[model samples]
Target: MNGSEVQFWSFVTAALLMIIGIYAIIFMDNIIKKIIGVMLIGDGVNLVLITEGFKPGGIVPIISEKLYNQSPGIFQEFADQASYSLPFALVLTNIVIGASTLAVLLGITIKLYQHYNSLSVHEIFKEEKI
Candidate 1:
């Protein structure tokens, strides 16, 4: 209901998203699930970065005459250093990479399916001659 409560919930939700993503990556058998797991982890991480940038009553980092009239908080420098943009950008790059990897994996999966007429990974491996 209050600010601290909201912040606490945000962190908890972020942590849960991260945990779910890890579990999906480790335990899912399908290649698609693994890719989705990676995305879920990315979501959690992005949430954490944005959350860290939160400061109660803090203004946007834009420079304006009114803003200049106000003091940048004592932690402003640190906050600026820890801004979320870079991390978000990194996640975007990773997502693109992840998608490419998934596409390659899907191609492999499709080839296996065509050759063996089955989608089960174990079946595909059993059909392998070498």
Candidate 2:
């Protein structure tokens, strides 16, 4: 309900997601599951970053007419109430990179499945000659 409560919940949710992702990665035997875990981890990190930049009673960091006309030196004061844009930008970049990474991992997984006729990492490694 309040700012601190929201931040606390956001952090809790992010930590839960990251924990699930790590559990999947460490305990799941399927290559696909591992890939999904990696994606979950990425998403959790993005969530945390976005939430970290959240501001209570904040507005977008845009120079609106109201802000511009407030005072000659109002920009500095307005900045205090503006949510940071860097986290959002970083999240966007992270999403793009995560997508690319997932694509590559899926491609590799597909090839591995084709060669091994299975998606289980344990099985694949067991079949490896060397």
Candidate 3:
């Protein structure tokens, strides 16, 4: 399809992912499932950022020294047609942070399972009622 259509669909997909994640986080009763929900939300946000940065018929936001030396006009044209880099950078940073957070959450879940011998949120909360 066209550029606008592609962007529209991507945004819809991102919204759906975020909705599902929120549902899981609020309704699911397992710690691991809650962690997955958090990850899904992060992924949805990342997708939106990447989609916003996308440009149809655009090149990467990189300039080769050779291309720059070829002609100022060509360099300017390339710069004009390049996609935005900031969103990509932000997504990269987010992915790293999300992965680390997921790791820590999973580790904690494992420890909780070992202590409580169950993964249900209700079971864990009941133990903490004291």
For residues 17-79, write the lDDT of model 3, one tens digit per residue: 999999999999999889989999999999999999999888988887887787767877877
Model 2: per-residue Cα lDDT over 8-62, one tens digit each: 8999999999999999999999999999999999999999999988997788887
TM-score of model number 1: 0.59
With a 3 Å backbone cut-off (N, CA, C), the pairs that clash in candidate 3 are: none
Considering TM-score, which of the candidate structures 1 and 3 is the better prediction for this target?
3
lDDT of 1: 0.69
**TM-score for each model:** 0.59, 0.89, 0.94
Q: Which candidate gets the maximum TM-score versus the true structure?
A: 3
Q: Any idea how many clashes model 3 has?
A: 0
In candidate 3, which residue ranges exceed 4 Å CA deviation?
A: none
User: What shift in Å separates residue 118 of candidate 1 from its native position after superposition?
Assistant: 5.4
Which portions of model 2 miss their true places by more than 4 Å?
64-73, 127-130
Q: Give the per-residue lDDT of model 1 (tens digit) for 39-104.
A: 788778767766675555455554556655576563566465433445556666766876787788
Worst 10-residue lDDT window, candidate 3: 67-76
